[model samples]
Target chain A: MIRLVPRSDTPALLQVATPVMAVLATMIAGGILFAIMGYDPVAAIKTIFWDPLFGLAASYSRPQLLVKAAPLILIASGLAVGFRAGIWNIGAEGQYIIGAITGAAVALAAYPAPEMWIFPAMVIAGAAGGWAWGMIPALLRNWFGASEILVSLMLVYVAQRIAAWMAFGPMRNPEGFGMPGSRNLQQYPAASNPELIAGTGAHWGVVAAAAAVLATWFLMSRHIRGFHIRAAGTAPRAARFAGVRPETLVAFCLGLSGALAGMAGLFEVAGPAGQITDKVGVGYGFTAIIVAFLGRLHPVGILLAGLLLALTYIGGELAQLTMNLPAATVQVFQGMLLFFLLGFDLLTRYRIARRVTA
Target chain B: MIDPIALFLLLLSASTPILFAALGELVVERAGVLNLGVEGMMIMGALSGFATAHYSGNAFLGFAAAALAGALVALPFAILTQFLMSNQVASGLALTLFGLGLAALFGKPVEGVKAPTMAAGPLGLNWIVWLGLAMVPAIWWFLNRSRAGLILRGVGENHDAAHALGYDVRQVRLAAIAFGGAMAGVGGAFISIATVLQWTEGMTAGAGWIALAIVVFSNWTAPGVLAGAWLFGGVTVLQLRLQAAGVRVPVQLLSMAPYLATIIVLVAISARQKFSRRAGGAAPGSLGQDFHALR
Candidate 1:
């Protein structure tokens, strides 16, 4: 018989080591999966993990890393705050879509105009749009006692449909022979989010992501609200007694995450994606969930985790081109990482012992 | 000029997947576990079932394979939540991602392949649809009248008390989760084998998520799931009819109706529970909490 006994204190070493262990385990499992699928497992692994950094195309791919990681880091930073407070806003994807649409709506309405204020104004509108969409579930949870998890997720589908409608209906580009997407925002100098430096791939969104990490770190470690969030997560009754209202926290977390996710969407629409289309949401919001967990719900950890996940994305694309690896392989790697992390988390909380039969 | 009987039959076929998936989830939730991986399981079932039917040329056997695949896939979640004492919500999400990715990886082989059709049953309905229709009463009777179900409900309501009473909470929950997986698998197979008759990547789409919403709208009852499924089915059939008849409504907007309806129904039910003094329609007490039997 096996017995699991609870540990009184978790060692800090184990906390750091477990995520590392999970990553290593996923590599081994992913390699085995590749082998089973008749691919050259070692070469596939190298193509995915090593080639993106040190391969012949490293210089070009290295800069692209920041472009990919920017949205993920930005979104995960916000999600970590809510997750720490035991509030789940899993519908960041929906908020992202709405944010992009609203943000782009500003530009589309002011099309062919060279206004200096369009970009910043679009940012605020985008945030408000996401905040409003997020408030639906938050308010529902606060007043009606609905599960925010389900509500938030259901809204994702709704948001996707809305995006499709916009692409084909109101937002469709007029001049380009009836293509089902808004005008490319990149061509609009006043509204476009351009790269700050020449070859570094650093856009305004990257700067925002850096700011979010620092801000989140400050909020979590140095603020009373951070203390309240941790308290609420660990012990709800005690936090309530200490005068932290659950409703207010719910609204704050959901609204804050929604706004951040919305900003990420705006930045993407104005920069990399360049237009609001039916396929604007390419699973960044969902991927950020894994990023948040893999980062241990911490800011600095999230920064690093976002970069690592970004590496996987770029490398996965490289592998697909060179080694003919399936696109789904990267997704499987991410899922396995989370699973292994969750499974190994048990080691931090409990001691496994074998029972001696009498 | 539309035939009501044909529409009704379309509704029956359209709703079978959600019915099976929701009914399965109802049982799992009743036993105090929330496996949020229904979407993953369903997609897995759709792929594996379609692939098997394509290769083996036996649609019934494909369903068996799907049921097995679903239960097997669910085992990881069971281990994570039940044995490892992991957080159920996070674990369930992980299961969903993992299942979807794995299915997509394997599903590449069977893409665009046609699924073999099974023999039709009475009224030109598929046997699986009939089986799903029959499950409502069987599950209702099982939950309300059977001794085993009483024990299962006992475990869900209060695991510690049930444990004290010497009922193995872990065993009961494990069984419930496996049964839920099997049902979801069959539901997914019904989509690929009977309805679409073709394999496509991510073909189940959000049917599994819809099933999850339906379970909530059902108030955790078997018969309620049937009604919820029919509501969704009716909306789907009506939208297709409208689209076919060249109605000017945007197809995307039309597709949004069922999800919007689900949200409204969820909010309404939740409001009722919150405002009412009795609070009679409560979820299973330990629904999302993990159980660790430490003696």
Candidate 2:
């Protein structure tokens, strides 16, 4: 028999190492999974992990990593802040969709006019759209005491429907003979979020992502608001005694995450994705939850975790192209990463001991 | 005018999945374990049930396989939360993500495959629907009359008190979680084998989450779960019919009806509870809390 003894103080070092260990464990498990599916395990793992970064097609795949990581990093950074305050804003996907729709609406409304201020105005609209969408749950929770988790998640389905409606009815590109998507923003010069440097894939979204990282790090470490968030999560009664209003905290966290997710969506539409479509929500909001936890809810950790997840996306595609692996193989690998992370986290708080036999 | 019997039958079938999952979750919550991975377990069951039924040419066996598959998937969550004492919400979410991915991987080969045909039971309804309906009273009796049910509730209400009274809290919770998993699996199987009759990626969609909401909507009662599931089912069928009717509104907008209705119901329930000064009625005292045995 074995027993788990509670730790007086959680080992900080172990908490940090668990994510790294989780990644390695995921790779091994992914290898075994691939082998069971009748593929060469080592080759499959190498294709997913190594080939995207330094393999023969690295030049093509490396740029895609930044393109993918920007939105993930930006969205994850925003999500981590709320997560720290015990706010589960899992409806980032909805905010992202609304942002893309609102942003695209601005661009299309000003079609054929290359105005200097149009793009900036669109960005603001995108942020506001996401913010308002997120506020529904926040306001509901504050006023009616509803569960934010369920309300926010329900909004995702609603948002998906809204997006589909926009694509089919309002946002359809007139020039494309009634196809179901807005005008490709890439072709529009003033509104396009093009790569600043050739072949680097560094667009306006990448800049925003980097800025978000620095800003989040500073806010978490240096701001009094951050203190309130931590205090609320760790000790709610203490936070209340210290004058942290629960309603305000809930609104701010949910609204801030929504705005960031919206910006990410706007950037994605104007840059990589190129247009607002029916299927715009590709699970970034959902995946960012995993990224937030995988990063240990730290800004810098989120940045790195975003890159690691982005690597899997690139590698998963590469494996699909090189081998006959299913496209969802990456999703399974990501899911495994979270499981291992959660499982390994047990080590930080508890010590396993053998039961003495009498 | 719609045929009342046909509409009721559609509502029954539509609500059956949510009913099964919500009732299962009702028990889990009563036992003070919140398993958020119902979506994952449901999807896993859908694929496994469909695959087994397709291979064996037997729908009942397929459902059995689904139950086993769901319970098997939930074992890791039980171990992690019960023994290891990890964060319940995070572990449950991870379980969902993992279950979805694993189902996708395992289901890749069986995509679009037709399930074995199911035979009708009493009242011309599928056997699963009857099972779902019967479970309502059965669960009501289990929670209200049975000794084990009383012990489970005792454990959920206060693990410390239960422990002091010599009941195995961990064992009771683990059993509850496994039962929830099995029910969720059957719920998922009902979708693929009974309703859609074909496996697709992410087919359970957000039914699991809705079921979670239904537990709260029902105030954690077996009867309330039944009511919530039917209301949700009615909204779903209405939306589909509206979309089919093409009544000027966009199909997308019509599709949002069920989700929007769910939010509205939740808001109304919460608002009533707040205004009436009843702070958290019928909620399991230890729901969503981690339980660890200290020596």
Question: In candidate 1, what are the lDDT values of residues A95-188, reduced to their tens digit?
Answer: 9999999999999999888989999998988888888889999999998888788888888999999999999999999986998999999999
For model 2, residues A162-278, the per-residue Cα lDDT tens digits are 888888888888988989988999999988889888887889889999999999888888999988898899898999999999999999999999999999899999889989888
How far out, in Å, is residue A224 in model 1? 2.1
TM-score of chain B of each: 0.97, 0.98
TM-score of each candidate structure, all chains considered together: 0.98, 0.98
Q: How accurate locally is residue A329 in candidate 1, as Cα lDDT from 0 to 100?
A: 89
Deviation in Å, model 2, residue B46 alpha carbon: 0.9
Single out the weakest 10-residue window by summed lDDT for candidate 1 chain B. Answer: B273-282
Docking class of 2: medium
Give model 1's TM-score versus the native structure: 0.98
Clashing pairs in 1: none
